[model samples]
Target: MFSKEKIILAYTVEKCKKCNLERKRKYQEGDLLFAETSKCDSCDGIAVIEKIFGETIEK
Candidate 1:
């Protein structure tokens, strides 16, 4: 029988080109790859979207 077993969660990864700072957060609307985002907390650099992916969680 077919049944639901796992939950897939989507995430977005952002990084700063100048400082190499990386961060992962939940996916949101209008998120596109290579898009410039907020400023980096560790340095004076702009964060850009690096990758977008999903992971399955066992229930």
Candidate 2:
């Protein structure tokens, strides 16, 4: 579980993007980016700002 301070990307369904997602994206408070909910993995992939790219970053 990541804290709000750790939030990097917020994932939501395409439709949700029209509302909640857009609101957060507009803020861009940090490394925030919005991805489709279906694409979400951990934490529903919501509010996940830190990308643990040690060995997970595979092109």
Candidate 3:
């Protein structure tokens, strides 16, 4: 018997250059690359959308 199972998950990456902080979270609507996001938690820095990608995992 053969079975195939896989799941794909999307994610968004945000980074702050001032603090060199990086964050990853689930993908959301209206998210665009290089777009300015919320303030950083570590310091008074602005976080920007760095990248958006997806990964596949076996179930």
Index of the highest-lDDT prediction: 1
The deviation in Å at residue 37 for candidate 3 is: 0.9
Q: How many clashes in each candidate? A: 0, 3, 0
For each candidate in turn, the TM-score is: 0.88, 0.14, 0.88
lDDT: worst 10-residue window of model 1: 1-10
Q: After superposition, how far is residue 56 of candidate 3 from its true place, in Å?
A: 0.4
lDDT per residue as tens, model 1, 9-32: 999999999999999999998999
Measured over all alpha carbons after superposition, the RMSD of each candidate to the real structure, in angstroms, is 1.6, 14.0, 1.2
Q: Over the stretch 1-46, how does candidate 3's per-residue lDDT look in tens digits?
A: 8776989999999999789799999999999999998999999799
CA lDDT, every model vs. true structure: 0.95, 0.30, 0.94
> Runs in model 2 with CA error above 4 Å?
1-15, 18-32, 39-59
- In model 2, residue pairs whose N, Cα or C atoms come closer than 3 Å (at least 3 residues apart or on different chains), thus clashing, are 7-49, 8-48, 8-49
